[model samples]
Target: MPLNTRILLDNRPRGEASVSNFRIETVETPPLAEGQVLVRHHYLSLDPYMRGRMNDAKSYAEPQPLGEVMIGGTVGEVVESRHPRYAPGDQVVGMGGWQQYSVVDASQPGALRKVDTTHVPLSHYLGAVGMPGVTAWYGLVKIIDPKPGQTVTVSAASGAVGSAVGALAKARGCRVVGIAGGPDKCAYVKDELGFDDCIDYRQHRDYPSLAKALKQACPHGIDGHFENVGGMVLDAVMLRTNPFARMAVCGMIAGYDGQPLPMANPALILINRLRVEGFIVSEHMEVWPEALAELAELVGSGRFRPRETVAHGIESAPEAFLGLLKGRNFGKQLVKLV
Candidate 1:
């Protein structure tokens, strides 16, 4: 039996997660059942949504029980396979959790997507070409169909999803404004990604002033809003939304752990005639091929660039996750297990 090190939730986090919340324990890899494959984790995708899984609160997905291996998505290489469909050395992406190895049944819905790393880096399968990239595409193309000359605003603008959205909007001929935490992130969005403007929300004392800044950035009110950090930011954006403006609510990283409360923005939503919709990335998985093609072409042509902030080693996963919640990650955050 293969010995694997896994990070398990030792205690539920109080507000923010720390190393203390996780315990690294060694365990034996379970014997592969029929149609199951054993995989050695190569890369782990550390996302903000995992914060919700750390608690026992009600959410779209179940919370991780104490002593249970923390849930995550990973890119791995199959080491042992009892399943005919998979074989040794096959690289695949799936819900593997924060562990050195995992056993996956091929029949599951999120079993794995086989990857060809000779063309693209295998890590890209867990980053730009994977979940975060897909989220940005579907939210922008399917949900918010930005038109030429329209003003587009993306919160958490320097992160993976935000950057992708801004680049896609710019490619579509729409003026994009990114709202991030600090000057460095703002500069990256404006100067590097070619966003028309960027707002450093941390420098702004009040949401009203932030709203004014956004208004100034957008001489015309925002035509579409990609909400990543909800709460006050959503409230501020809602105050200046154009009529028929669409909002793709991707995440609420602001309230994920600190405080669990519904934001007060319905009055503004009604007044501005905004259409806000919350969607899970999985909801649009079937249509991913089309989005992936466009994104891949843009990437290949150098039109779209993905920024990634990577933390090395499985031991760094907790800190990396906390960094994501604190907006410390510049782009998509990942942990290299190998």
Candidate 2:
């Protein structure tokens, strides 16, 4: 029997998440039943949303259960298969969680998917051409619909979702501005990702300071925004928003640690007539095909290569995830389980 090592949610966080909240265990990988395939994970995606799921609170999705495999997206290859549709050695993507291997029921519609890694690399399936890319597409195209000559901005701009948002907006003829933590990330956003300008939010601590920086960067004012970080970032963006600006509230990572993140000015939404909408991308599964096709083509063409910060082995997932929450990661954070 194959030994499958996985991390489980051991306890709920009080305020901020800690590595102690998780437990790692190794168990015998069960034999695949009919219509099941065994996936050996190569790369495991670590995202900010997982932090929110750690708390036992009312949320859009159920709180991650105690003593269960940590929920995560993984790209891997089938090592054993009982399903006729899935053959051994087939590259696949699925919610294989924080584990070295998973026995997935391929019978489910979206349970296991074979992917083409020729134009796009296998790892890209977990980042650029996968959920994050689709997330960017939904936010940019469906929610914060930008027009030519308009200015579109994104927070956490160098990340998987934010970088794609900037790229797509730039292709739409919109001035793309990004807000990131450090100078290196800001530079990558402007130079590499083709963003018009990128503001280093770390340099500007207070609201006025950041807003001043934003105003300087966005000369025409922000017409649309893809918000990943809330609190100060959102507040600063709101102050400089143009009339009837649209905001897609993808994530409020600032408030993920069981804290109240009140908006500095709720009145601005009314005054500016901003169409601010919070969304969970999974809810709109209907758009995935359209979104993925466009994203994959962009990645395949080499227009944008989403930067990644990878940690080796499953043991590193906790520390890497902690680093991500502290804004230490440059882009997409992942664990190379293989």
Candidate 3:
């Protein structure tokens, strides 16, 4: 059995999350039972949603229990398989957690799906063609359905989900704008990701300044929004929305550390006739096939390129994840387990 190195939640965050919250350990991979497969993970995904799960407070999902392997998405090859459907050497993606190896019960629905690395890189199964891509699809297509010539904007625009949302919306003929942390991120969002305009949120400390920038960038007014960061970003977006605008509230990274994030202006929703909806992509299993197909086409055809920021090993996950929370990571944050 492979010796698995894993990170566990050592303690919940008091205010801001730090590397101290995690603990690392090594253990032997348990014997795979019938219908199980052993996966040696090549990469593990670090996402903002995981931060919310670290808390013991009531949330859409269960809290991360102390002393358990930290939850995360992973893509790897099946080194050993006892299941009829899965085979050794089959590349698969699953919630393999923050570990170098995982034992998956392959019989469970959506537990492990084989992926081809011929066109799309195996790591892409954890990014552009996987959960983040699906998330961007659901938010834009299902919630903030924008029409051609309409202006749409996304926060954390250079990120995994936001970049996908921008690409998907641009393909639909909508003018896309993005909000990012710094000059370099904003540049990537505009130059590389092809957003019409990218605002550097750090340049504007308050909502008023950010709102003015949005007005200049989105002259047509924001018809739809995909919100990843709340607080001032959301406030600015709300102030610039056109009538009957739509918003897909995917995450509120600004308040992930149990901080109270109140809307600055609640009246804007009714006044602007906005439809703001918050969603968890996992709940809408029905849309995965359709979403993944389109996203796969976008990625496989080389139309959309999702960037990644990788940390070298399991021990690097905590610091990498902390940087992600602080908006220090440039793109999709990943831990290279192999």
Candidate 4:
């Protein structure tokens, strides 16, 4: 029997997550029951949302159980199968977690799906063409719905979801401004990702400073926004939004540390008459097909180029994930298990 190396959540973090919060162990692979298939994960996605799942608190999803494999999206190949729908060597994408292999049951809805790596790379299914891409599509297309020539802003603009949002907004002929951590990310957001302008949030640590930079970048008041880092960034973007503007609230990474980070200007929501909406991309599964098709096309045609920060081996998953939360990993962060 093959040994399966699994990384489990050892301790819930009091504030920011550390490597000590995780535990890695190897065990003999469990036998697959009827309707189960054995998958060998090649790549595991490390996303910021996983940070929210770490805390034992109320959230959109259940808290990640302690002593279990940390939940995550995995792209893998079926090495063995007892399920009729799956066969040997079939590439798949599923919630395989921080383990080298998973025995997924076919009866689980939306749990396992086959993927074709012929045109798009297998790792992309974990990022651009997968969850993050769909997340960008949902927020921009469904929520913001920016018009051509309108000015739109995105926080954490160099990340996977934000990068996609900027590019898609550009395709729609909108003036896109990105708020990122530093100069290099700002440069990549503007030069490579094609955002109209990029603001380095690090330079402007305070709300007033960020507001000034945003004002300079967006000469015209922002008409739409894709909110990623919620605390200060949201406060800054809100100050410059036009009346009747739309904002899609995606993630509030600042408060993920169990801090009660309040909005500096909640009144702006009312004063600007902004239509702010918060969404989880997974709950809206209806749009995945459409979103994936368009994203795959864009990626395949070179119109949409999604970058990645690859960490080698399953053991690296914990450190890589911690880096993602701190904005250390550029683009999409992934652990290459193979």
CA-lDDT, candidates in order: 0.86, 0.92, 0.94, 0.92
Candidate 3: deviation at residue 263, Å?
A: 1.7
The order by descending lDDT is 3, 2, 4, 1
**True lDDT of residue 269, candidate 1:** 79
Candidate 2 lDDT over residue span 1-338, tens digit each:
48999999999988889999999999999987899999999999999999988988788989999999999999999999999999989999999999999999999999988999889988888888889988999999999889999999999999989999987898889999999999999999988899989999999878889999999999889999999999999999999999999999999889888778988999999999999999999999999999889888888898887899999999999999999999999888999987
1-338: candidate 1 lDDT, tens digit per residue: 69998899999988778889999988888998998899999989998888888888888877888988898889989999988889999999898999989988887766877877765677777766788888998899888999999999999998888988998899899999999998999998988889999999987877788888888898999999999988878878887799999999999988887686466667877787788888898877797888777767767677767788889988888888888888888888989888
**With candidate 4 superimposed using the best TM-score fit, by how many Å does residue 61's alpha carbon deviate from the native?**
0.9
Clashes of each: 0, 0, 0, 0
Q: How do the predictions measure up, each by TM-score?
A: 0.94, 0.99, 0.99, 0.98
Candidate with better lDDT, 1 vs 2: 2
Decoy 1 TM-score against native: 0.94
What TM-score would candidate 3 get against the native? 0.99
**Alpha carbon lDDT at 252, candidate 3:** 96
RMSD of 2: 0.7
User: Which ten residues in a row are the worst by lDDT in model 1?
Assistant: 257-266
Candidate 1 root-mean-square deviation in Å: 1.7
- The runs of at least 3 residues in candidate 4 whose Cα sits more than 4 Å from the true structure, single-residue gaps closed, are none
lDDT of 4 at 18: 95
Those runs of model 2 whose alpha carbons end farther than 4 Å from true positions after fitting are: none
Evaluated against the true structure, the overall lDDT of model 2 is 0.92
lDDT of 3 by residue, 1-338 (tens): 98999999999999999899999999989998999999999999999999988889999999999999999999999999999998889999999999999999999999999898888999988889999999999999999988999999999999999999999999999999999999999999888888899999999989999999999999989999999999999999999999899999999999998778889988999999999999999999999999999989988998898899999999999999999999988788999987
